[model samples]
Target: MKLSAIAAPHLFIPPEWDREINHIVIDSRDVKQGDLFIARVGRDNHGERFIETAIQAGASAVVALGEPGFRCGILGVPIFSTPDLLDHLSDWLHRAYAGVSQLDLTAVTGTNGKSSVTQYIAQLLTQMKIECGLLGTLGNGIWPNLAETRNTTADLSVVLRHLNDMAEQSIKYAALEVSSHGIDQRRIDGIHFKVAVLTNLTRDHLDYHGSMEAYFEAKRRLFVGGNIGAALINIDDGYGRRLAADKDITVPVFTYGHSDKAEVRYHNVELNARGMTATLTTPWGEADIVLPLIGEFNLANATAAIAVLAIQGFPFESLVAAASTLQSVAGRMEVYVKDNGPLAIVDFAHTPDALDNVLNALKPWNKAISLVFGCGGERDRTKRPIMAVIAQAHAAQVWLTDDNPRGENSDQIFSDVLAADGSDNFYCIHDRRKAIESALEKTDKDGIVVITGKGHEAYQEISGTRHAYSDAGVLIAQGYRKAGEDYVA
Candidate 1:
């Protein structure tokens, strides 16, 4: 597309320069021939510093937040200045694709389980034969046709572009994971969500939000933003309950939980090595649902999914039948049990609440439990000690290991975690592989071993480098092959 064509309504560019621009890119590293580079102000570094690099790499033109001198430095590319480059980029893209609308968006936000819930909703929609798109931690794009992305939540400009792309592709629905940071930064400004689901809030992103109240408020923005047609929330969570009580929500609110008072309630809950089954009673009707995923938390997750689907007009019988087919979300309460050995679970329970929930759910299966987990470096340190207390309180044996420790001393992170519990039953291993091996070696045959923190992640980042690592891969290497294989080690 010509520069003038794409920038017509959003920019007052000279008509002659329309043919000069061909492609648009935000990152200077990705600049190509005929590309228009957008110089954004980043958290740590100014993107303008790379203007010379981008132009030299064959950028045709440059759009910057502020003035980029008289020209585009050495490459002499045309420079366009805007006070708010991000907003301008979004506006330009939206104008370029005027036919696309942002109406049918659905955002899910919380500390944990957001990705799983988002994925579940996407899967459910796909099973219903709806043309849907998903944008979350796993990546973003049309369901079953995802494109890998580094950011869990895309920037405002990229989000608008993706929404436009989805609309162009005839996508009827979009499930989005609204990160607290993204919410606070207005990354989801223009999009209007039809349904907003709040899973739960916990201490996970203190490094960004700084306080629990601030974090909760960030999540509240999605529902209170007045764009959503309905809100699906887990009333069992204090934050979710508080959000449900909000007087400003003009849309319908559907609450789900184990509590009888919830609009969508579940009772006669049964969880086992096979999975979970519960009697669900909603305002619409009552039905039994058997979920393949384990954990009471997962029951709540399933309930939330059902509640959202029901609010969206899906029949109760369909939900009950479909609930059993819901597969295990990768790394979230994933169970592997063998005929002759211990049961093993791998999860992404890095937060205190998540750890407590996972450990509590596994308590019924085995009295002897071993947990292997670690706190990430440069993250919310407040949860480190809290997680220690929760793990030590729940697991019979605890193996503390390095999780990520990005740029921070591994020993320091472990020390803080150890100090949280003040328990001698826990052993520290700086090497993650050794920790898993040690846990496997020490646990009894009937014991259950849980490897937590990094669930679906294929790599462990440390000191600015990501090394190939996966808990499941490690377990598989040590004789734990299939879902029911015994690990004799």
Candidate 2:
């Protein structure tokens, strides 16, 4: 495509100038010969400051929201300014890929379970023989061909580009995890969504949203605007219930939960050492589902997926079969076994509500429960105390430890967590690895150890650096194996 064509509505250039442009890049480090560098302003710093870096890397043109701090004219590169460069870039990218009309897009957002549910839906879609694309913490790409991304949700240009790329590869559908920050910043403005799923809302990202209400409002954007055909929500969540109550919703709404009032309700829900089984009562009919994934919370997640797929015109029997064949999402309720002793579950339950749900789901197992978790630094601190209380209330033993205390004192974070649980039943360990080891070492043959927070993540952020860390990796390294497998170490 020509440079003039790419920047059409925003800027005018001749088709001959197309040869002067190579590719579009937001990051200065990735800028190459004849590339158009997009200087987007971020929370920490402005991309304009890196203009020289991009120029030095062979960028022939620059697009920014405002004037570049440096003399771009001297570099002999064209500079373009738009009202909102990111939005313009997104629009431009969307136009570039106008051939992707048959794509079905499903976006799932909430304080937690976004990644897991997105993965679940993607897996089921793939099993149904539909070409699918997945975008979330595990990275964005066609199913089984994921690439690592810096953000849980990609930036506007990257997102559209990925979609276009998938379309070119003949992918029929895509499952995306929409974060509150992504929605609030309008990063998803230009894309059309076939179905939008709201897992639940809780106290999280207060540092960004400033309040719980604002956080919910940010998540509400996914369902309110654009081409969203159906809204799949969790009626058990307060914010979700309110969203369902809103009469202004143009799209059909589908509610899922244990509540009878929900459009897709569950009954006779059972969670045990093996897994979970629930009798799903939907608008179509009633059916029993046995999920390989543990926890009743996961049952809710599964039901949300089922409801969304059903509303999208998938057959109910196919949805149920696809769901029942679904396996556990990595890191969310992941079970690990040892040669002897208790069952260990590593989950991404960082929020208070998530913690409560996971613990409650494991209640009927008749085993001593040991919960190991912590709060992330530079995030919503309001939930730290609540999670501590929940863990203490539900678990036989609560282990409070570090969870990516980025740029915050580990001691201060630990202190705040301990403040929530005043009882002697809790133990504080500043080191996360040590905390997990301690939890496993202390567990008996009839115990259930749950390692929570930072699920599917491969690193731990501390201060300004990200260190290689994985809870599951550490557990496996410490002589832990599948339930019946022998640990060589």
Clashing pairs in 2: 337-481, 337-482, 337-483
lDDT of 2 by residue, 1-489 (tens): 556777776765544334356567778887878877888788888887888888889988777777423233446776666666664677666666664556888989988778778777877888788867888888889877889988888777678778878887888888899999889877677778888988889888888989988988888778876558888889888999999887778888888898989989988977766677889999988899887767787788888887777788888888888887777777777778776757788888888888888888777777789989999988777778888888878888888888989999988877777676464567888889999889988989679899999888999999979999999998789777644212211
Query: TM-score of model 2 relative to the true fold?
Result: 0.93
Q: Give the TM-score of candidate 1.
A: 0.92
Q: Report every candidate's CA lDDT.
A: 0.79, 0.80
lDDT of 1 at 182: 87
Candidate 1 differs from the real structure by a C-alpha RMSD in angstroms, to one decimal, of 2.8
User: Model 1, 378-415: lDDT tens per residue?
Assistant: 99887888898898788888998999899999988977
TM-score of each candidate structure, all chains considered together: 0.92, 0.93
- Which residue pairs show collisions in model 1? none
